[model samples]
Target: MTDTLLTPGAHLFQAVEAALAGGCRWVQYRDKSGDHERRAREAQQLLDLCEQAGARLIINDDLALALRVEAHGVHLGQGDGDPAEARRLLGPTAILGVTCHDSLPLARQAVVNGASYVAFGRFFPSRTKPEASPAPLSLLREARAALPNTPLVAIGGITLDNAHTLIAAGADTLAVSHSLFGADAIEARARTFTTLFNQHSST
Candidate 1:
């Protein structure tokens, strides 16, 4: 996730570039500044960077921007828009992710609505969204069982220390923000995060 505050100004792209170089395969452009021009420019740049690195870029809550930049996909929060409509517009190949919070029912609905993946969390305290409702680790387990075929994303307050627990509990992806871009060594942090998944898969 890209945050203007976390990585202000040009540092955003630099941080993302470092992450990509460190084996990060997916990036979600998550600036909520409402600056259409800047967002579009940054999203396009991020998309280009991701493409060059053989990674995927997902625009957050901005279907129009995603389409404008021809991004890999768009992630929709509950109030963002209709996932089915997004799916139709993005076509079958685009990756559509829906933030289902802690509800399995919402996740199920998202899948039915053509979401490529469903996200659940705030498993731990979140700096990005402090007031966001907390989701239990068991939610990941339950979602895994219920949405067996869909990719499950664990979001909110994810860090290297606690990331393993989420993956162990059945989270296919970890959506991190502060802990990653806020690190002094963004590349190393990203590499370590990627290593966690690799180590888990090998086991």
Candidate 2:
């Protein structure tokens, strides 16, 4: 996930490109700046970068922007919009992710509403959404058992030290922000994260 504050202006694309170069296959453009024109331009640029890297770009909470850029998908929060409606517009192939916090029922509902993946989070103190409610590791375990086929995303406060716990608990994806783009060596940090996944898969 990309943050406006962390990678503002030209640094945004640079950071994203570095992450992609480091084997980060999924990129989420998550700028809440409310500048429609700028957002559209940035998102389109990100889509192009992802395409070149054989990666997928997901626009955060912007169905229109995702559609305009022909992005691979859109990640919607609880109040963003209807998942079913977004799914209908984005079509079956486009990935539709919904934030379910720590609620299994919400995750189930999101799936019924056409969500391709479900996110849960704040497993640790977050630099980017500090006030967001913390989700328990048990939630990921339960959600995985409940929604075996659904991709589970764990967000907030994910770091190299603790990310493996989330994966062990059943998180298929880690929606990181600060720990990634905030690093001095963004590509190296991203490569480390990618290595963690490779290590996990090998075990």
Could you tell me the TM-score of candidate 1? 0.98
Shift of residue 66 alpha carbon in model 2, Å: 0.9
Error of 1 at 72 (Å): 0.5
Per residue, candidate 1 scores C-alpha lDDT tens digits across 1-203 of: 98888888899889999999888999999988878998888889899999999999999999999999999999999999999999999999999999998899999999999999999988999988787789999998998888899999999999889999999999999999999999999999999999999999999
lDDT of each candidate versus the true structure = 0.94, 0.94
| Per-residue C-alpha lDDT of model 2 across residues 129-164, encoded as one tens digit per residue | 788789999999999899999999999999999999
| 96: Cα error in model 2, Å | 0.3
RMSD of each: 0.7, 0.7
Off by over 4 Å in 1: none
Q: Look at candidate 2 and give me any clashing residue pairs.
A: none
Clash list (residue pairs), candidate 1: none
